[model samples]
Target: MKKIKNIRYPGKYGLLWVIALFCTGTIAFAQSGSDTTDTGMAEVSIELKYTEANNKTKILEAAVKTKVEGSWQGANGVAVQFYRNEAAPEQLLGTVTSDNNGVARMILPEGEEKNAGPEYTYIAAIKNNERFEDTEEEITVAESAFEMTLVEEDSVRQVHISLQTSDADGQEIPVGEVEVSLFVKRMFGLLPISDDPETTDENGEVMAEFPADLPGDTAGNLVIVARIEDHERFGNLEFSRKINWGIPLVIDPEKDKRQLWSSRANAPVYLIVMVNSMLVGIWGVILYIVFQTYKIVKLGRSKAAADTV
Candidate 1:
């Protein structure tokens, strides 16, 4: 009789092991490939604004940002270019680098104030960056004017505002039935002074009663602002002027005298006294312990000498 050795073939368990090894190898290969391939350029955003402030100063501001891991972050140190009107004959206004907050600004020449056409188009662009693709933002604004005046009559204060738009021929025409706003510029933001939104009449003028009790700087100078906001044709327009209209602020002479938040030279009297007392108490306890130790050593020596005698 011939002896047959036991033979075992791979069953279901062997098949599962093979499939697991294949899957692991496939996952590792895919991960390694993804590490070398380009993940594509970052998503970028640009916001452009045209502002005309005091003395007919025109400014173009571009704010740049990039989306990272589903959140928007400022793209600092990015260079941005400003252009006026169309691309073919585009007038290169200026180029500026973004600050820490991703804001780049350019001040147009004083002559730009008179270059208003039927529609003003401003473009801000970024190009040839490794991290970000070529991006641009365009904003179209119409020529608009906002004016503010201060008047005081018979113990009553008033703010007068006017809104106007320019025609194709560059002539100023009053815009009627448009909402204008009055604001007082504060440290952080604009304070609305109007109880209800005021709209312009046929003459493109609106008046609001100014409050007499608003506090101002030491010189009693307050900035009054007139704004035409989000007009379909004109976009945003603003004008401001500083005038001696607000109430004078009264500063206390002793405001900086010996307070908790003051400098060390201006430390509070009670605090100084309390700290000094604690230090004295701690030192006194230490000195008393030292004297008691000295007395014990001397008494022990005297006892030992008497015993020896």
Candidate 2:
């Protein structure tokens, strides 16, 4: 009864064929949606700008935008609003129309929706309308008061900028892998310290070596500025802090008289020559007039004595 049990091929290759077919079919099904027209995705974006009015009023301007197919045309006429994510119906900041560019802008009064802390993250949302599906986006902004620390030991001075951001509740959270820009303030303008921007590490910190040739105040004071310019998430923000990490102005009093750059030395050559020459000429004229007056007085006294004798 060992007569060729139906001559079936029980080889592993046959099983592999069946598994491959199953995987291919599954993948095809998963990606089949991309070819359909109903899989359109909508995007909502929010940008924030902070400004201080008279250093007392903290103003925040938020630009909300709705985009469709990588452009704002998809969400045209969509009713967009910007407000804090809160309970109930949520705070209704002024409703703005999405212009042809699909952007709606509004300014939140100072103290109304304070995003300075992590807990106060803002939200930009659009109501679902007949044209498109309802979509929303949340925004988190940290105070622009970025802090930097400088350390100099053994001629190896290192400057580090922290990359911690506040959550919706003003809670400190480490931000990973963000671009940072460093600049040194000079007499004319901000000078870029490095040609390439630096990125924050896992510890939410960006560090760079202090340039020795960087010029500072006459007393070696430097106003070093660290900035995060035009970030997709954080927008444009900067912080300038003063540090004494530069070469002070070098002035030699003997070989090189004090120029305008050196406070210990005299004024410029042209200014000294003009000023001293004027002073000497005026004193000479005064001394000549005084001598002539003394002689006249002496002659008058002698004539009076002779007349009396």
Candidate 3:
């Protein structure tokens, strides 16, 4: 019985013992690394969950987490510093204390770098202290932007929406294989015309048929819109064009109402006839006046010719 009790599970301490044994060789490796402080023991460690990405304004942010063994969760109230590593000049962005839930927030300011992609590298670190070991975590983020346009053809009755990148210059350089969504404008909301996004070709253009089934005003005026959303680089970009392709609108609730159109289409037959008769009478009087002037000029020319003879 005594031997069995001694051989049984060592509880939490037993798990730590096993982990220490497994990480014994690696602990020496961590000591040599700049990311680690010489820890008196291995039970307490810092973890960086610095990979969560958020882009607002010109900055990128990350979250840092720390923990100690035998504790239920995070090691609370730990002080941490955020850093941006370019090459020679490493900037200390700010210092934030770990919250009650044991999360420290960090930031990287102004997404510009000397590298080709201008990818920014950031580091979150817990400074050396008596209670816990110092630890560092690093992550990278890149800059991006987007551009879009819409085109229409009357002969073919087709709509072509093109997507490109204007990140470098204001010029429309073609970008291939990008997803684009198309929508047709409606009275209350936008009606989706394309079931799926059309991928751009080598020339950075996607063609989709404009929908003609929706109801519009009597003139059949409608607009087609294209949108790209939640893109990591450009965020949300949209463009729209007006076209006349929708069905003619009917304002009357009942059919066969003998209405040319809604209230605006109604006109009295007498009013129309009177307007046309007045226009014809005015034009006829003007024509008679022009004829009289021409006859007078001809007679004057004849008299001048006789006098010269």
Candidate 4:
């Protein structure tokens, strides 16, 4: 009996100990789950770009996105701030709101980069956003530019593109062995003008013959674009010029005549005639059936009168 009592005492405590451990583990799991829920705030990303285009134009662009269901989606209407430097009392360039595609742009005035050194640092930031955590992106881009010239001689058109970088004294120095792209802007997107890629020679210049037969606007105006894209040293640089070098695209008035692709009010004459004729035929059949029924009823009444007589 003594041995059994001792065993029962330890057994009771052992069962209680097991129950205590289970409770502690459950509490820990619940705490961990709550932490996970608290971290459910959207994760946001920011992309910064520096572009130098025609007529010494420079612009800063930022793209904001958030993680949703394991996929990134644009976060529209987010306010993004641009700065020339990251150090505080930051040199604020401008503040802009993100558009439908979560892109924000700020155009820097001319000569804005005159004092900017050979290497420039640009920063874009989002602050105090409730739906997303504060985030910032920075890019350091080297100063570069493109010079483009158009020449037509003896009915042969050629475009000249030059890639140059700023020296220590801010003089234009040639950057050789770099690839450049030439394009013509269309209604939807840019179209490549050359079949082969154009690479700069030792003089930082590349020339390509332009297609003389390409269609342009009614005035024969073409917007030509030259670009150096995704360069590790220079980033993206673009230059554009407008010239009267293309064939005028004259539209035909016959295309506006009523056809299958025309609007409802401009439907084809044949389709309208066929539909009206079908409607008239169906109504005629219905009216003939009604008239026949009336005649049969009248004959039945006359027959009944004869039978009574």
Best by lDDT: 4
Best to worst by TM-score, what's the order?
4, 1, 2, 3
- Residue 269 error for model 3, in Å? 30
Per-residue lDDT of 141 in model 2: 46
Q: For model 4, how does the per-residue alpha-carbon lDDT over 269-291 read when each residue is reduced to its tens digit?
A: 99999999999999999999999
Q: Tell me the lDDT of model 4 at 181.
A: 92
Better of 1 and 4 by TM-score: 4
Per-residue CA lDDT of model 3 for 1-309, tens digit only, reads 000001122245656555564588667435522222223332234444322222233332223333333333555576766666621224777777777776775543444343434344556666554444555655454343333334455644576665555444344567677777777777688888767887879987777766556777788877777766544444345666676777777776554333444253455556667888999999999999999999999999999999999
Instruction: At residue 228, give the lDDT of candidate 4.
Output: 83
The ten-residue window of minimal lDDT in model 4 covers 1-10
Model 1 alpha-carbon miss at residue 93, Å: 1.4
TM agreement with the true structure for every prediction: 0.73, 0.43, 0.35, 0.74
Question: What is the overall TM-score of model 2 with all chains considered together?
Answer: 0.43
Instruction: Write model 1 residue lDDT over 268-300, tens digit each, in one string.
Output: 999999999999999999999999999999999
Model 3, stretches more than 4 Å misplaced?
1-155, 167-172, 253-309
For model 2, residues 125-197, the per-residue Cα lDDT tens digits are: 5554433334555555444335578888898978888767666666677777888888898888899999988
Q: Which structure is stronger by TM-score: 2 or 4?
A: 4
Best by TM-score: 4
CA lDDT of each prediction against the hidden true structure = 0.75, 0.61, 0.55, 0.78
Question: Could you tell me how far off, in angstroms, the CA of residue 121 lies in candidate 2 after the best superposition?
Answer: 7.1
Return the lDDT, model 2, position 54: 23
How high is the lDDT of residue 87 in model 1? 34
Higher lDDT: candidate 3 or 4?
A: 4
- TM-score: model 1 vs. ground truth: 0.73
- RMSD of each candidate relative to the true structure: 15.2, 25.2, 27.8, 14.0
Candidate 4 lands at a TM-score of 0.74
